[model samples]
Target: MQEKALSPTVSTEIITLTINGTSKQLEVEVWTSLLDLLREPLDLTGTKKGCDHGQCGACTILLDGKRINSCLTLAVMHDGSELTTIEGLAQDGELHPVQQAFIDHDAFQCGYCTPGQICSTIGLINEGKAKTLDDIRDLMSGNICRCGAYTNIVKVVQEALERNHKA
Candidate 1:
């Protein structure tokens, strides 16, 4: 009689990502979600994990300047991609325009969804697809704020769009 191994060796891959304007090379398990990699080893806890299934949009992040649910993607899948988390939105002690807008408009409650909402709004602005109020609502519907801050959130986004156009 002999003991047998129940599983094979774990697979891992090294990835380079430009996060928050910094380049990092990290070795992560193949199956590790981007959300896990961010919150765990990178210690970036601002990206929430409300619903790991990607339905809640709590883990939304800017991957290559586009918004994507970090929980829905694998860390290995985004090699060579540039990512921006909430932590990176502020620079040199000054918050990004959208971040400042959120604060000015008080667009958050409980603050759980603020990070995702802000990131999504930035992506939306970058896409240049949201033109009107309804367009903003439709484009931002993916990110939910259980605190019911939709009104102020919309205002913040609208202001951000205007600011971008004026820039």
Candidate 2:
């Protein structure tokens, strides 16, 4: 009996992105989500994987300085866009203000959602969306912390914003 040849599977498509400060090109599957492509292909694991669905903000990343749920977006859709992850927020081994605020305020419990929280906060600050406590709450509603440290998270974000404003 002769074995039949199996059809080849295309696992990647050409993708180009400006991540952090550098440009990157990689062959990724058309259906691959930005989260997977970022974590697996690019080795930028700072973006955590929670509920692959958009319900959770665990896979949040900055697209052109705006926070977006990476799991809900396709890698190819952002071909020429600028991308920023938790990894990009730090510079010269220094944590971004938001990241430092989270640490200072003990904003996270399990630390599983820290990256998303930080990313979302970055967006909220950059967009000037986190003005009042209610505004912060509304803006961060999408990112859920399983440990329920929301109060501290809010404080951290607000504090970070204040510090950023002062700087």
Candidate 3:
């Protein structure tokens, strides 16, 4: 008797998204989160997976130049939207000013949350909402640092703002 072979399941819908200045078209499950799409499907691992929920803000990314929690959003929801991950901020192998400032200030402990922090900072900076430490804190309230490096994170944002203003 001949044995029957099982066929693999295939998805029909294709999602087109622009990530880190590049366009990607992929077939994915409808329930796939942006975090999984970025890290696993696209191989952009800089966006860390922390809480896997929106609470931690570890998977923050810029969607149409605005910061959003990728873990809470479906990949298909961002179709046709431009995304900027941690990988997108650098140019010519040089770190973005915000990224460098974080390093200079030692803004991270375990470094697991740095990507979200930096991305959220970039969004806050672009929004012109972090003019004061209090303002920065309020704006960045979404991103949590489990290592308790809030002071250093705030310092990095302030330094980056000053540097960016001067340049």
Q: Which candidate number has the best TM-score?
A: 1
TM-scores vs. true structure, each candidate? 0.95, 0.91, 0.90
| Highest lDDT model number | 1
Total backbone collisions, model 2: 3
lDDT per residue, candidate 3, 1-167, as tens digits?
75556855544468788888888888878888889988996899999898897888899999999999999988877668899999999999999988888988889999999999999999988887678889888999999999999999999888877877887
lDDT of each: 0.94, 0.89, 0.89
lDDT score, candidate 3, position 147: 97
Residue 132: error of model 3 in Å? 1.6
Q: Please write out the lDDT profile of model 1 over residues 11-100, one tens digit for every residue.
A: 999999999999999999999999999999999999999989978788999999999999999999989999999999998999999998
In the predicted model 1, the residue pairs found to clash are none
Task: Provide the clashing-pair count of each candidate structure.
Answer: 0, 3, 0
Tens-digit per-residue lDDT, 53-161, candidate 2:
9888999999998889999988988888999999888899998878888988889999999999999998888897577899989999989999999999999888878
Better of 1 and 3 by lDDT: 1
